[model samples]
Target: MTAGRVVLIRAVNVGGAKLPMARLREIAAELGAADVSTYIASGNLLCTPPDDPDAFDRALEQAISDEFGYFREVISRTPAELSQALTDYPFGEAPSGHIYFLTGEPSAEAASDFCSRDFGNGERLQVIGRDLHIDYPAGAGTTKITAAGIAKGLGVTGTGRNLRTTAKLIELAE
Candidate 1:
């Protein structure tokens, strides 16, 4: 049996987001989630949320906003879905990349526009459903395609976690 969903909160513990993991777990528990846990300080939450996971995602987002005085998108995925992302990774085990978990899959036109846009060399982008896979060989710090750029191009909300961290979250969720 799978553990549950991996709830990822966008841009936490960085740039003054400051969401404490212990408090996060407490919030989830208050919301009736079971087996609540968190990974790292970057807002990776693991739990079997109450009722619908999507609903839980939204509730968590709201709760965080209410309690922490800031808003952040909370995106969740089942263990199977997380595993599928690993399998669907287009870089084929290149070992370094990130998966941007979108609120919903972008439209074909948006995906095409984002794909066609020149973000500079050594950066490969592949849009897979709600996941945007990006591989920037020279390191993300040097990439022209940024989080803001992605949001603008895709016209959607999302949060990104690196490939290794994603694998770790999957392991923890299972």
Candidate 2:
């Protein structure tokens, strides 16, 4: 019995760690998730579990440690929860692969500070409610623009993936 959770794992491929995603699905299976699926090589998992997300988190963490011999920070959100983050994004779909970081709700003061800062690459930042929607028309792998800089301005810890990752997450949730 799989837990109903959307799990996002980070730093899997760092330093050529060889953290096979197939093993990740197997770990989810051991955690008692029934309908287990992985979104991409970036380490996103959509699973239906027998227990609630809290239990799944613990079990999955332990399983991953035992299997991989390392600890990974696992963030789990329900599809509905992530859907709200997507809805709050303000950009009107400018580029196909625009990346946005879904971070903690920035304080009103922090948001105000970010409104005035420039990203050095002529990039634009918008805060729609709690979510930070960044229009990176230049795409990732560029030296000038970065999601981290935007997160720093907003005072939150998060990462952004391409638009392809966003669409797949939505599709898996559906």
Q: Which numbered prediction scores highest in TM-score against the true structure?
A: 1
Superposed model 2: Cα runs more than 4 Å off: 1-3, 58-66, 69-71, 96-103, 127-130, 143-155
> What TM-score should be assigned to candidate 2?
0.74
For all candidates, the clash counts are 0, 11
Measured by TM-score, how close is model 1 to the native structure?
0.95
Model 1: pairs clashing at backbone N, Cα or C within 3 Å:
none
Residue 49 accuracy (lDDT) in model 1: 85
List the lowest-lDDT window of 10 residues for candidate 1: 115-124
**Model 2: how far residue 68 lies from native, Å:** 3.4
How high is the lDDT of residue 155 in model 1? 89
Top candidate by lDDT: 1
Question: How well is each residue in 1-174 modelled by candidate 2, as lDDT tens digits?
Answer: 233667776557675645778888888887778788887777688888777776786787677778777866566777776676666555666573343444367788887888667656555666655455666566545535444666577776455655557666867866
What alpha-carbon RMSD in Å does predicted model 2 have with respect to the real structure? 3.5
Q: What stretches of model 1 exceed 4 Å from their correct place? A: none
What C-alpha lDDT values do all the predictions have? 0.88, 0.66
- Backbone clash tally for model 2? 11
